[model samples]
Target: MPVDAPRPSAWRLLLIFSRIGLTSFGGGLSGWLLREFVQDRNWLSEEEFLNGLALSQALPGVNVKNMAIWIGFKLAGPAGAIAGFMGIIVPPAFIIVLMAVAFSKLTDYPLTSIALAGAAAAAIGLSASMAITAARRVPRRAFPLLCLAATFLAVGIFHWPLLWVVLGAGALSVAVEYRRLSSGEGI
Candidate 1:
């Protein structure tokens, strides 16, 4: 968001997050959030959203929930963070319980299976789109590209444990960047 942009109220943030939580499906809530806050509303700049996204992904909880709080804090402070957390979590949690009960009885239907398959396909597409977006933001440098390739091969091709790959790759990336910055070649 621009420096001159008006800040949204906590109530508005809560309402938007609640709506997103209630309506979003097929996963990729992070992608939906990027579109909603950055592209559609211009409430946050792309860089801000992406930075929060990276942090959220690195953290231990659900990415979308972490993003909600991050965004809320950026836009509206602590109260907004509370609103965002509640908005993104509480409503959907209740709905999920209800949906689980309903879906349990519908599991025998072929249509149910088909619908689930379709949802899964959509989810994969959304996740792929998000991944591509993030990848595009990576600096087109040898070290970064090599790290990206190594991480991809480790996690995607070799099926190495994700935690270890992330830890190792992240540390290497940080050390390299730190060295580069220390040498005054930082981009």
Candidate 2:
């Protein structure tokens, strides 16, 4: 059976994406964003979400912000994109500014430093969790494995400049993808 196309609704799109922005915490909001719009609501298909993710990563901006713009445009055109961008940025910016003020006032205290150290540790743990989750979802193939190994070598072992590491990884990924395509594998 053919699926019906979704009709755009600006207010609904604003409300939903805003709520997502407000609630996302401890990182990995990308997966949660996918779950909210693609799986739970069926506003986007899995393929669409994946494509948006790829595009967002390629763009020169925060991944989540790029994603919000792309998804918003997909849902309700340019107006939706603006709304989504504002909804995602404003509240967090306001909260962060307030937190920065508080942190500045408390910077000299040893207890504050200790508390920040603990928060940093928790952030690292969260980052590792996100990495493991993403790794589990990656296809287990020789090309991907090679790319991963090369990335580790470039950044972890050799301590190459970040730009070089990114460029090398990106080139390797493209080469692998090209080889896969030539071998008649689906992308």
Candidate 3:
């Protein structure tokens, strides 16, 4: 569902991610990215952004960073990926270092702590919105729905190790899809 977004130069990509990195705090960076790239800019479809979100979650390292690279690569290429990666990572890295120094004193303040808690709560709401948006797009099929529920149970409820859950569930899901495809069921 990728539409023709005016191709942003690498510098422009960096500027965009830099804006996100500079402003976003207390988490929910992916939500900001989703709004920026998908809903606001139409740089990518919700489906593509959701797919990258899945990969970013599955792979090791930072989810937002991975998503930045994924979006950048999809939009431009390797250079664009680098632009996205550095744009998100470098700016935030510096700001976090600076904030850490300042935050030591801030942490002792009750109001500061309260404000941070409120921000965290808001971030969770943002994350929930993103999850719901992605969930709405899942195909209406028994196996896929089952896989979604099982994965949720394993990770969210049972607190299973993500590696095992992903490997086992992914294999099962792939097998099911393969069977459907082979049987001319059109996965």
In model 3, the runs with Cα more than 4 Å from the true position are 1-4, 152-160, 182-184
Q: What's the lDDT for residue 100 in model 3?
A: 91
Q: Write the per-residue lDDT of candidate 1 for residues 42-102, one digit (tens) a residue.
A: 9998888899998998899888999999999999999999999999999999999999999
Residue by residue across 34-60, what tens digits does model 3's lDDT show? 999989988788888998998988788
TM-score of each candidate? Answer: 0.91, 0.74, 0.88
True-structure Cα RMSD, model 1: 1.7
Q: Which stretches of candidate 1 lie over 4 Å from their true place?
A: 156-159
* lDDT of all predictions: 0.90, 0.76, 0.88
Better of 2 and 3 by TM-score: 3
* Residue-wise C-alpha lDDT for candidate 2, range 65-111, written one tens digit per residue: 89888988988899889877877777777777888999899988899
Give the range where candidate 2 is weakest over 10 consecutive residues by summed lDDT. Answer: 1-10
List the pairs of residues colliding in candidate 3. Answer: none
Write down the lDDT that model 2 would get.
Answer: 0.76
Give every collision pair in model 1: 1-45
